[model samples]
Target: MENESPDLQLQGLHYLTGAPVRIAIRQGRIAGVEPLNDPPASLRQLPWIGPGFVDLQINGYAGMDFNTLPIAPHTTSRLSRALWSEGVTSFFPTVITNSEDAILEAVSAIARECEEDEAAGSAVAGIHLEGPFISPEDGARGAHSRAYVRAPDWPLFQRWQEAARGRIKIVTVSPEWPEAEAFIRRCADSGVLVSIGHTAAAPDQIARAVAAGAAMSTHFGNGAHPVLPRHPNYLWEQLAADELWTCLIADGFHLPDSVLKVAMKVKGDKALLVSDAVMFSGMPAGTYESHIGGKVVLTPQGRLQMADQPQLLAGSVKMLPAGVSHLVKRGLCSLGEAWEMASVRPAKRVGLPFSAGLEAGAPADVLLIEWGDAGGDGSEPRIAGVYKNGVSVWP
Candidate 1:
């Protein structure tokens, strides 16, 4: 079916207040929002209006893998359209650590897809480069190949940026290297967000990275050594840095509830959620071969771990909706707060227009959610409808 006409009105319960509202749309943006005076017999009959999710770190969805060598044609476009049902209106296709040439090809293909496909062009906020410039240590490196890991190389990054048509908005780096501070400063100055992740950096180095404009932390508390010094570790340093926004993978398996609560409390609104999901996100639970980890298993419980060692996680199989559900289920945060962390907050961090959410004059990138059971039951939100730029795109 074709999308709804740009000029239209949608009636639903407001996501934050749970009050009925009528949202006016015109010319692909929200014209106004007004509260409904009449009391409905059943609020469950109406969907909840909220911002469409904006994922800052997702490698792929369903069967598509962004980091796979020779990314298939239209893979980016297919991924973009696939995410609408998942309530993701926008996302950053993540390209992880690989050989210089492989990285270039992957990004260039994504850039081409954006240039050629209108839907992809609008949905792909930017490219998230998750490394070659990171720690070479075993645990901190996560699944990134150690052979490709090296010191921060601006020239090499520049080549990737050029291939991506300047769409590399975020770069994850470890501040452990001697040249990291300068590299981070350069990326910040060039309008790229520098995120600290998969790191073995000391407290001083982490502080310096923040001083040099490291704006965010990637999947905080996951990609790191199993053990750390009791004090003066990178985790403590990032939490103390008020300017650093933290992104957590609230997939339940990634971080414990206690840690999630503390980070959310410390970072407050600056705390965000990211799926950091891989190609197996929407696939059935089964054993699969991954480019990052040779063999991995997707458990029915939604945990993705190495086949050989179930203790080690390969990547996440859940999406943003599941993360929001986990946070709410764990009583870590309220439904509204959890939604914003996965939606507007992440958009706000990236300076995207979708940050305005249901406000007037913001782009009408919205989700109509069936959240009737969310208040008490802690079930995942059912995305009944998704609208991008005021046009209904999902059933």
Candidate 2:
């Protein structure tokens, strides 16, 4: 990579605020932003300019599972291109619970992708380990195979981290285990973001994990027992805790609009969104044989579920942009607010700056969205351009 910072002038409305601006894109960063003015005839026009989404919980995409060993040679590039088409310029390719060999191979594959391609490397901010350290209970476990669930082992994780070349940025855990507090402490000490998820943990255990350094809740409202006591359960405990940030899967099905509203209200600036998507994401609505979750189906309702047992949801089939549109349709937030939840908030949670896009000195991980008559709330958005570090990755 040479010292090249090509320049581009983007004339459009800011996606979040809906204010017109002329932003100078240079060297993969936002070099300048100014209110739009009469420009020369050749200036390119777009309807929206915004930060590219930063997804933290994507397990897989485009029929390729991240946990499978010996991942397809072209899978990372394919997934990167697919996600960028949907306005995702940066993301964490999540590695969920699987066998030791499988998990190592998957992370190793991701590391190789980063080592191999600069664009792919810049796109993958880091790795998200959704864990073999989660709950083993049936419903709470979701689709994770119980055979692989185990207690958190620091030495084992160190080995995995080495395999990942220390690319593991986040790790989800269940604090119910006796060893969880120490595990969270170690993770936090090492600069890895610790997120609480997929647990049957009690209020005290939850408190202990926070005290030990758990910083966020993963897919907060889901990944738990279907039933719970009203007042002192994990949901309420997590909701009330001021120190913990809450990330939700607002894919319409994972949480109702009412719940999404409440979560956004309570978390305020602390709220973030994740896809929690699986390998089967982006496939058409139909049943497909899954090597990990047996038979899974993509429903007309835009949800992925266990084909044999439709009552339980498999992982999400959503991309972050669609999730943002759903939030806007539900009237839970304004376009700007919803976009913040989808893109800005999640990136900030992982220590990225709030001015990570559309601001001077910020990386040019940006999107140009052209909405139809419904204003991006009803239909799939039109992605006219995608820039990763000021270079248009979309044609």
Candidate 3:
């Protein structure tokens, strides 16, 4: 699969050259990349060339939720194909706050699908267990079920690790939770990525977690109360902590332009964009009942709000590409920088080796886009095409 003839050639697109370049693919890997003026006659002319986006945290898409109980056998594959259409070549199936049995069951089902097929774009690189070891406070916990939220338990984590068949990639927990630091260490020792989130952890706790191998702050600012005093809090503490990588849901509703700019300034290249999108995403704008929380509504403005509280963010209505677009639209970063936040940064977060933008000898996972005015409204970017392993997987 890795050693075969160059089957596809894409020409007239910029490579980080931001100037036109031609790319050739062989088998399932990149064969060559050259200036656009002198390309093979067969290469297809296109407008954009970039690395395919990789989402590190995505719950569900296209009306199919991964956390649905009595796990559906084909749900992962179905969602994977749907995400590929949206330019997500890879992602972690994030399962938030549920009973222990439900978590294990979900992990088992995902592991089965990953074991069955590697090409299934929704391959479970790892399970993002976002809760069960989180803040129990109402506003701090977001929409997670408080009954299931508890202190971190090593035995429980070990059981889940076994159930995932070693596919549990990242675990999100509150640093303030008792035993969280130890759990972070255990997760690090087992080669899993630990992320701090849904917490009121002080700067010292955050530092301790970082030293213990908790490397990320999940959706940094979205889960807190609407109003925060002008002093140190999880938000400001994380921003000041240089060792932490922050993941932001760049959906306009999750954060304001001002806060987004500050976060980008603090994290720089370490900032990653995630959808944190829920089951309601990819569905029509309307009221919907969530499995974890009560009824929620997707507003016409693309905000997902709690039916009881209009000001709160239920979850994100954005996807990975849109998240990147939000960063660029807000003038927080350039398109190339935003693209890296969605692609290379996430690929590195998940420990994938092929983080290079578009280069020869890299994986043939690429995205084609048609650029528009930089100041244009932040609508979802048009995906001209997506290639996975040198094969055209989306149009």
Candidate closest to the true structure, highest TM-score: 1
lDDT of each: 0.92, 0.83, 0.80
RMSD of each: 1.2, 2.6, 2.9
List where candidate 2 sits over 4 angstroms from the true fold: 1-5, 39-46, 353-355, 372-377
Q: lDDT per residue, candidate 1, 1-395, as tens digits?
A: 25658589888888888889999998889999999777478978898888999999999889998988899889999999999999999999999999999999999999999999989999999999999889999889988999899899999899999999999999999999999999999999999999999999998999999999999999999889999999989999999999999999999999999999999999999999999989999999999998767899999999999999999888998999899888888789887899899899999999999999899999999898887857576556788999899888897
Deviation in angstroms for 20 in model 1? 1.0
What digit string (tens of lDDT, one per residue) describes model 3 on residues 270-343?
99888887777788889998776688999876788889988767788788777777777777888888888888
Candidate no. 2 TM-score: 0.94
Error of 3 at 77 (Å): 0.6
Residue 5 local lDDT, model 3: 44
RMSD of 2: 2.6
lDDT of 1 at 73: 86
Model 2: per-residue Cα lDDT over 26-99, one tens digit each: 77678899987774343334467788888888778878767777798867767877888778888889988888
- Rank candidates, lDDT, best first: 1, 2, 3
Which residue pairs show backbone clashes in model 2?
5-27, 28-389, 28-390
Give the lowest summed-lDDT range of ten residues in model 1. 371-380
Worst 10 residues of 3 by lDDT: 371-380
Query: What TM-score do all the candidates reach, one by one?
Result: 0.98, 0.94, 0.93
